[model samples]
Target chain A: SVAEQLTPVLRESKFKESGRITPEEFVAAGDHLIFISPTWQWMTGDEAKIKSYLPRDKQFLVTKNVPCLRRCKQMEFTGVEKIVEDVEGEDGWVTHETDDMNLNECAEEMTLDSSKMDDIEPKNEDEDDDDQEALDMEEFDVDNVDPSVAIIKPTPIATTKDSETDSVIHTRTYDLHIVYNKYYQTPHLFLIGYDENRQVLNIDQMYEDVSQDNAKKTVTYEAHPHLGPSMLAVHPCKHSDLMKKFLQIAEEGGNELSVYSYLIIFLKFVQSVIPTVNYDFSQTIKTT
Target chain B: MSEKKVFQYVQFKSLVHHDFWHKLSDIKLDIEKLNESDKTIFGTFTNLNAKNCLLELDCTSFNSNFKTAKNNFYCKGTLKNLNTIESFKNFNRNELLKKEGENLLRIIENGSACKNPSELISFIVLTYADLKKYNFHYSFAFTASIEPLIYEVSPSQNITDEFSENDIENFSSSYHLLDQQQAAFFIATKHLDIILLQNALDVNQRDMNLKDHNLDSTYFCFSDPSEFPYAAWILRNFILLLVKLCPILHGKSIKILSVRRDEKSSLLLSKLFFIQLPNKIDLDPINMKWTGWERNDQGKLLPKLANMSNSMDPIKIAEHFS
Candidate 1:
């Protein structure tokens, strides 16, 4: 990363090669979201802790107190999730899960711990691949996250189950903060969780809300860069590669993705990690 | 043993975001330089929950005039930020604390603290922004009289008990902007009372809107930076102003709301505390025992140092991963 450090892709023109965004791109992407969505706001996390590089107000983006009502266990993914389990290991955009000889994961109707769901979930195969692999990415993230494993792409709203119909709807809230990842050169997302009574939740409790796919590998608990205290962070390691997928498509479609739409596409994919933290991701990516 | 009723007023703490130091460095290198002038800056202390009170300072705290977020329960307090490493190193910590305490006492005695309750809390931050090394050294102090008074803490109440989310927002954001008579202090209560009935939750709205017509207690709200059971130390002076001005509230309980929200709930996870007001009065400013100096984690009397190498170094800031 020395050369990557010395000559960081400081321009948006070279985004495809760098797979990183400059500070200016981060602000551009952030401002676009701010104007369109009230849910996403720019916060200067305590004045002292602000990264001098980013502008004061545009240091990070936060959509606060997003409601996450049900745990990942309650989510019922569609049947294709079983197919993903078969082809889970390698980077195989073309390798369709063949007819199974023997069953391993989803076929057994056993009551599995939700974290065990990772064994059945496919990995983030979005490494920086060549042209043909980039072509395979088109049908995946139109609304974002591979529709098959797109974290609980369930019925838009979870209908209350009957046995607990009158019981107090125990809901957890998460404060989602997105900060620039200078090394990965993409925007990183963090979650601060609160329990039913509005008290800060421990990491274990927060894990219950994160999708088992990401919970096992991608998400980590660490100190927030600006706001002190560790938060549940969705690692930005693969965000740029994932972002480049959108870039390749937009280039092929002859519509350049504006740096502003970075976060719009960002939240779309981040949904695949913590699918249920219902912050207002209500807008489509406006490419202008 | 016949027990005497003992009271403990909420203590305020400082939530000094690192941006304060960064701003101080910028000001020193660009504006102040070697002059080391006593710059007039300001900080805010909120009154949301008794245990969450804090006098907060950040990059904006250095500005002579600044406006906080509209609905955030932060009220303005004028403070003096003394600059330069030499001054910060040489000043008498005890004398500075006393001077700050006496300044607050003078405002209370002169009746200005009554006119603006926000003035009840004040401070002086002695700072040394070491630009070359990227280390910031500073000592912070908030003025509050060191006196034990009779008080009691009640359980935390949900904010919806007093008003709906909209009502709290309407009152807190607009309270400081008031201009008419009996405005600042009295405005908080009256403004909220009207909104409680106005923003009544629609029944078809949901089960969360099940709050009844509970007119239990009024709030003295401020954006609190601390968590529960430990309020910002700045509340001491505000409570003192209350005890000094309104004798009718003397020995009576006054409920204060922590206008701040915790990480858990975005819906103004504000906490309300019913505290028994002090029964006695002491107006002698000279004899007052003042206490408030930001402490080291080991509870020692020393200025804290923060190394900003990862934060301010050119290589670090330019290429460091999050």
Candidate 2:
């Protein structure tokens, strides 16, 4: 009887038509699970009242006054090859020749007659070509070159053109499983993200969400035994702390909020890591 | 005594290093002096061997006629000789303590001995005597293993019901919990809240009626076990946090429950004993009940407790508290 009264507020989202969604569905909807409770309902058994508790904006969820990169757009290297070529030729030879000439001129000024005996060799074009070929061969040395090193080309940084474009953030999709950690007697979030190609996403990009000191303390390298050592994972240690903070904020509104409202608030806080993905915790799939 | 005194039950086990026996002997001498000064108190020491010793101190003579004092002391030779110890042959000697010993043995077998065995052993023995003198039921002993572990004396039924296969699986999977010593410490600290609650109930008796009972002024006495430093630190902080979180326990007098500086470890240990007025009012916002759901399968909807006809029935309240 209590389960019937508390289900609408504790497990299922108020916005969904189906009234229930599995954890897999929630992950598929691009939302991460911050917490789950089969019992311990803190809200009244009313749908409309629960819906009203959803956060209107993200201000309360995110950190304030921290200088963080709001969005990261990989700069397109449209003209990087031409730029690299220009840098190699102009930066290497021109700067070198000019510095040598300037030094020689200064030396001549100091000892005018003594330095004037040998005029600089009239611009040797043939020697310059030979020198360029020799440099090319050295740069392309197969025995000493690391092929993996060549793939990591540095991208040029560019400022955003306009406010709209600047605010457009890039985000990866993360699947969150809120497990009841019976050992700790607390709820824990197990998260794994993916790139556009469905490749596992590394957590190095999400370090900005946690303070530097906390980043060190919270992130632990774990190799799932069943999944094999290759299935290495970066786990955040303080899920209970995050859950407590979320509940505290929800309770601050004078009434206990539904799990949907809690989920929305959780997503807002995690937006610093996965900035632009539209998270829908209520998504349901039709069985064919 | 105006109120019946409850003796806090604690068990301490450390390595049987050479210096531990000598330090324990020294403590036996000191305890003898303390007993001579107070005729009502009596101390007895039994040297099982060079590595094993037992000290039993009784203060029942000093206590009022209605109260009872029970304490036990056990010591064994090096952890390597644990199988040879006669007391351990009795399978019924606190299963939780046995599990703790197994955990300690695993750690020691893995070659993780204490960095400073002599100091740790001395601290444990002194702390035991100090806590015993204060009417706290404390037990001290040694195992052959160098690795130290702590266990809360819990009801066997509760442990079986609460800890399932899922808990064991989760424990084995986690890197931190995989370490036997760390796992022992973690599990011990994690279960402390429930243990403390049970201890409170046992000490105060089963009577639930507290309409006009005094709500202020509560006291806690903590004895630090020197060997498991991490467990000691975590337990103290967890107790403080429990007080802060439990609405019924807020704004009561809190103190560092300890005796003598030399007897204390930077890491505090022992049973948490609280004294205060009975809380008749249902101050807890959340009430926990078994939903009859299977351990492996969490049901689609979380179950809730059914409304009772008489919410304030004393029987119901007592059952809930138990």
lDDT measured at residue B303 in model 2 versus the true structure, 0 to 100: 12
Q: Considering the two chains of model 2, state its CAPRI-style docking category.
A: incorrect
Best by lDDT: 1
Candidate 2 per-residue lDDT, tens place, A72-157, comes to 22111110111112221432110011122442343233233222212211111222233223222122122122111111111212
Candidate 2 structure quality by residue, lDDT tens digits, B1-322: 3333321221221221111222232434554433312122222221111011112222111112211110111111211111111222221222323333454333322323221111111111112222222111112222111111112222112122333455433422351212222211211223222112222322122234121224322323222332221222213222322232233443332222321111111111122323322233222313211011100011111111111111123453344234
How do the residues A93-192 of candidate 1 rate in per-residue lDDT, one tens digit apiece? 2111212221123223222333443332221221222411322212211112111111111122222223422223345677788988766778889887
Superposed model 1: Cα runs more than 4 Å off: A1-265, A268-288, B1-15, B44-56, B71-89, B106-117, B153-223, B257-272, B313-322
For model 1, what is the error of residue A141's alpha carbon versus the real structure, in angstroms, after optimal superposition? 61
lDDT of each: 0.55, 0.25
